[model samples]
Target: MRTQVCIIGGGPSGLLLSQLLDRAGIDTVVLERRSRDYVLSRIRAGVLESGTVGMLEKAGIATRAHAEGLPHTGTYLAVQNTGFRIDFDALIGKQVLVYGQTEVTRDLYDAREKADGIVVHELDGVELHDLDTDAPHVTYVKDGTTHRIDCDYVAGCDGFHGPSRQAIPKDVLTEYERVYPFGWLGVMADLPPVSHELIYANHPRGFALASMRSPTRSRYYIQAPVDDPLDKWTDDAFWDEFRRRLPHDSAEALITGPTIEKSIAPLRSYVADPMKWGRLFLVGDAAHIVPPTGAKGLNLAVSDVHYLFEALTSHYRDGDDHGIETYSQTALKRVWNAIRFSWWFTTTMHRFPGQEPFDQAIQDSELRNLQTSVNAQTVFSENYVGMPY
Candidate 1:
């Protein structure tokens, strides 16, 4: 097979890039190691930053999301039993859309299929070859057969564990990572949310987040030990702990129901510098990952897509190499900013194992500053709505 670009992942980042390129009259192909069902089955963060929402619109896939997704003008932050709101719209005239990542992927998939875009799923042992040369290609095995795609460039959207990043020579790559000592025990329930907007709470026990996928579907999480077992957390036990972390009013108003899905996700901040190397460019999770505290995991990925899509389009349409040449430096600038925000938010909200009293005082003062200072709230709102792409 021959194409202009070979995208090595069929998730939102890969699909979104392919969709945009296809609409731009550029030929591309997407390869996925898992079946479509398995890809969509994973539940992820739902908060959509403004940049991502705009990217969906540019790809002509935002109609469904705009129709079904909820819009939040602000979020709530609580210290112990006292809660305060940060009005994003009031601070920055912007609001984030509460749309599930699953729905976004579904929309991208539908768009790709409708346009007859090439997407190969369940391909194993995917490999990249001659990435540093003028001619680049990708190979994979499918159904006992081997296939190869010759393309002008390769997009590594295959995520953190995928082959794309590994293809980069070890000497050229520098990786930085921090694994938190705790994890988030999240539960998805078929009940109304505890609040209309999301609430991030810092309690004596740990950190708890009250969020939702929609008006009638609630998604909640509480911090737990890193090695906590899923089986040990029953539905009743999760609710008991969740309520105790919320303010008295919110706790009394909370509704409990059977959980549809539950899992523990460890927090981490990871970044692989230089997102691009020769004809290969790493986008999304392949390049960096942020803790979900600031709801930046998918947003950061989409931002990468935004930068890469622009660079690729310019290269193909106008014969411009400037964007491609500086893609890594440009993307990392924003990536580092987001990494800092997620790290700061996570540290402030969660209790560390050996946290000192001074550490607690610092966290308290930060939250108090956010509540009282317009500048602090504006900064939070700006980062929350997303820094400009």
Candidate 2:
């Protein structure tokens, strides 16, 4: 099948891109290797920048989000050695909404299913073949036979390890990477959140985060070595660590529920420059990845789609390729800005491997400054709440 755009991956970026393009009268196809159920049930990002909500609103997909999502004025920063609360809203007037990526994806998926000229092929298990030529196509196995899809342009939203990056000539790409010594162990509980706002704590033991997914479900994370086996920590052990890091006036207020999910995801920052080659372009995690401390992953993907859609719109209107021609450079500016912020937040909060005494002192001093200095807080707020869209 031939189309204006062939999107590889049905995650937020690919699905959202197709939705935006469809609204603008562009033809797009979305291919996903997983079943529709898997994408709908995936527990991914839970925070959405204010700007992201606006994008979903504009796209007419905010009905369920508006009804079910929780709105928070800001977050809290606590130092375990000494209990402290640094308000993010006081630092910046903006606030973020707590909504699951699954919700947004489900909405977009449904919208795509209903929109004309938009084809969402689930369970296609598409494989990337040749991308060096002007014409790029995806070959996938369907009904026990191979099929080919042709399009005017290909978008690699599959993710970091996906085929899109492999297609790029190795010599032409420059990669910058930093792997953190620790990974985040996230858990979800069925109890109500202890605090209305999110709390991030820095303690001698390690770093911990207090966040909520809904009024009834709370999500929290603590720092652990990348090599640490999750089996070492049981449900009670997890709660003990959480209680030590997150101190509340009343221990009764602490949210408690069945230990639902546990996993260790390493923290890292990665960036690939010039996200386009020939008729193929990359967006979202496929082009860049952040540590998630700044809550920018899902938001960045939304921004990427905005720039991509604007570029495509300009390309079609008045025959000006200005937007498409400059897509990489334009998106990179925002991508790099987020990368820096995520790195700063992640490194500042989490302990490094074999951190020397001096290095630990420097990190402590920096955190103290962030708490006491208005200037430092302002910088954090801008990136935390999000930069102007």
lDDT of 1 by residue, 47-157 (tens): 999989999999999999999999999999999878999999999999999999999999999999999999999989899999999999999999989999999999999
Which residue pairs overlap in candidate 1's backbone? none
Using Cα atoms with residue i matched to residue i, what is each candidate's TM-score against the true structure? 0.99, 0.94
Model 2 poorest 10 in a row by lDDT: 116-125
Worst 10 residues of 1 by lDDT: 355-364
At residue 209, candidate 2 shows an lDDT of 85
lDDT of each: 0.94, 0.80
Residue 22 miss distance in model 1 (angstroms): 0.5
In the range 1-389, model 2's lDDT, one tens digit per residue, is 77788888889889888888888888888877778788787878778887889889878799999899987776677665454555566768777889889889989888887875354455555666556666778777767777788877888898887878878888888888888878888988888887787878776678888788888888888898777788987888888887887755423468565778888888889999879877778899898889968688889988888888888878776678888788889989989999999888887777676777777687778878987898988887778777876
